[model samples]
Target: MEWLMYVSVAIIAIAFAVLVFYIIQTLLSLKKTMENISHTVDGMKSQVDEISKESTQLLHKTNELTEDLQYKSNTLNSVFHAAEDLGHSFQKLNGSLRKVSETVSKQADDNAEDVAKAVKWGSVVMSFWQKWKTEKTTKQADPGKEAN
Candidate 1:
């Protein structure tokens, strides 16, 4: 009876030792997993910081581009306004030219009858002068007839 009790006590002690050893190994494995997680978190933090810096640069570039576009649009607006002004000037000039052309046409039409009457009078005067000169030449050559 005493020997059996000793053997039973030894068996319980061995089982307890085995349990403690497995628990320690499990704890070690958990510690290693925690360390890996910490390293991964550090790496992610660095990547996040790099991404933040790059995003900041990108934002600055976008703002610069926006300003440049605004400036160019303003310049284009001025050019469009100039073109509109030029178009208006041309329209006014064309209107003035049309009025002048109409006035000239009206004047020509009004003077047409007067011009015809003046031409007839000038023709009559020239014919009379030519007849008088011819008679004078004939009288001078004949010397017997007096020219009245």
Candidate 2:
């Protein structure tokens, strides 16, 4: 009976040792897995920070572009306004010219008959002067014949 009791005690001790060894192995594996997870999180955090910085810079550039476009648009607006003013000035000048031309045309039409009578009087006066000059020259050439 003493030998059987010793054998049973030794068997129980061996089983307990086996269970403790397996537990230690499992804890070591869990530790390694946790360390890998920590490293992956750190890498992800750095990448996210880089992305945030780039986004901020991109936003600033976009704002500058918007301001430049606004300035150009304002400048173009002035040019368009100046062109419109010039067009109006041209229109006014054209209207004045048209009025002056119409007045001149009307006056010419009203005085057509008067202009024709003046031309006829000028032609008659020129004819009389030529005839007097020719007679004086003929009389000077022949003094005796001129007395008649």
Candidate 3:
């Protein structure tokens, strides 16, 4: 029995020693993890700040681009208006040209009948002249040749 009591005490002491050793090791590992986390947080802070600066620069550029685009669009709009005005002017010119063509056609039509009447009178006069010339030449050709 005395030997048994000694063995039991030895086992309990060994278990306690093992528990204390493991607890100390776990605490040391936890401290190392905390230190690593702190270093990582510091690095993240610097990266975030750099990203913020870049974001600000990008925003400024975007604003400038927007203003430039607005100005260009306004200029394009004015150009479009000018083109539209030109189209209207050309349409008016075309209308005037059409009107002039119609007037010239009407004037030519009005003169056509008078020209035809003049041509008819000229033909009648030409026939009379031809008859008179034939009679005069026959009378003057030989005086007794019985008509040329």
Considering every candidate listed, which one attains the maximal TM-score? 3
Q: Give the alpha carbon lDDT tens digit for every residue of 64-130 in model 2.
A: 9999999999999999999999999999999999999999999999998999999899899899989
Badly placed stretches (over 4 Å) of model 3 are: 1-7, 115-148
TM-score of each: 0.64, 0.59, 0.70
Shift in Å, residue 34, candidate 3: 2.0
Per-residue lDDT tens digits of candidate 3, residues 17-72?
99999999999999999999999999999999999999999999999999999999
Query: 2 or 3, which is superior by TM-score?
Result: 3
Query: Any idea what lDDT model 2 has?
Result: 0.94
Identify the runs in model 2 with alpha carbons over 4 angstroms from their true place.
1-36, 119-148
**Model 1 root mean square deviation, Cα atoms:** 6.2
Winner of 1 and 3 under TM-score: 3
**What's the true lDDT of residue 40 in model 3?**
100
The number of residue pairs in model 2 that clash at the backbone is 0
Selected candidate, larger lDDT, 2 vs 3: 3
Decreasing TM-score order of the candidates: 3, 1, 2
Could you tell me which residue pairs clash in candidate 2?
A: none
